[model samples]
Target: MSVEQVSIEDLGRELGERIAETPEYERFEEARAAVQRDEEVQSRIDEFEQLRAEFMQARQSGQATNEGLQRVQEAQDELHAMPVMSEYLDAQDELEDTLEAVNEAISEPLAVDFGGEAGGCCQD
Candidate 1:
């Protein structure tokens, strides 16, 4: 075979071998999996946001009394312990941090009070 033809064949084989050995392909697969996890987490976050809005509205409208606040708190607790991928743990941590900030903002007195009602508050 001519030297040029032999060199071209060797180059193609080396390229294939290098591709097989590269870590980037595995990393890419991992990243794709992580992205899927993030997408699921995002959907959960949207649901939580909607639920939170409803809870807030109920409290604001005096529909949710102390019993209602307890229900909301229970829901928040469930959300705080939501499932997330290990690869996307950072994203979950960020979400937790954001929720803490929101809690702090709503921690002030007279902010959506749920007092003066001792009755049953059920949400279905």
Candidate 2:
């Protein structure tokens, strides 16, 4: 079929399906599942999220302290130090890299940056 015969939405959906089948995507999915199934990682995530939320609330109320910000940073560091969390993060980064390369490829033939500028407006 000619390019004009396929709807943009259909092409987008097909692209998404193809991306989902990539090895990077598969690794990311597996790593995500492992993270979800690990109680220790989950607990650390919960702790980090709670600390971050409390920090945000304090900041919103104009009562945020350096100590609170430090606590949140420490919690984030501790969470990221976990083996499972590290693996998940690495897999996620690889998947993001793959997507970025695909985005560049798609953007190259277009007038705009397909991934970054397609929906944005008010540019000079």
Candidate 3:
């Protein structure tokens, strides 16, 4: 009897590409750009810290805007969509952290702060 053995390396390469081509992967790629800079993800831990500080300051100063909040939410969404592969997990973590910081930065601020504030009530 002959036995067939599959090497882990071969399996990994095959699976990696297959998984990377999924719609989810495409979404991940789109969302990831928001968090990655220079091919390196920002430190999530530091992002959280900065976020907290900024949030507190913004709220205290009453400088919050809707756009700011939207930016934070976008980061949060990106974090949720980040890739889960072992090789990419670290980068994901960085993105998550940066998102947290972004959230803090936008908290207490209206989304309009980022731009394009809705002007006047619509009467079309």
The prediction achieving the highest lDDT against the true structure is 2
* Candidate 1 per-residue lDDT over residues 55-76, each given as its tens digit: 7898788786776567657765
Measured against the true structure, the TM-scores of the candidates, in listed sequence, are: 0.33, 0.89, 0.29
lDDT of 2 by residue, 71-90 (tens): 99999999998999999999
Cα misplacement distance, residue 91 of candidate 3 (Å): 15
Error of 3 at 120 (Å): 62
Better of 1 and 2 by lDDT: 2
Cα lDDT, model 2, residue 88: 95
| Tens-digit lDDT string for candidate 3 (1-124) | 7898899789767756775665556555755555555233455534545665676678789997776666566655554454432325555555556545544555437544222334666724
How big is the positional error of residue 44 in model 1, measured in Å on the Cα after superposition? 1.8
lDDT score at residue 64, model 1, on the 0-100 scale:
63
lDDT of 1 at 77: 60
In terms of lDDT, which candidate is stronger, 1 or 3?
1
Give the backbone clash total of model 1.
0
- Residue 6 in model 3: lDDT: 90
> Clashes in model 1: which pairs?
none
Please report the TM-score between candidate 1 and the true structure: 0.33
Greater TM-score among 2 and 3 belongs to 2
Off by over 4 Å in 1: 1-37, 83-124
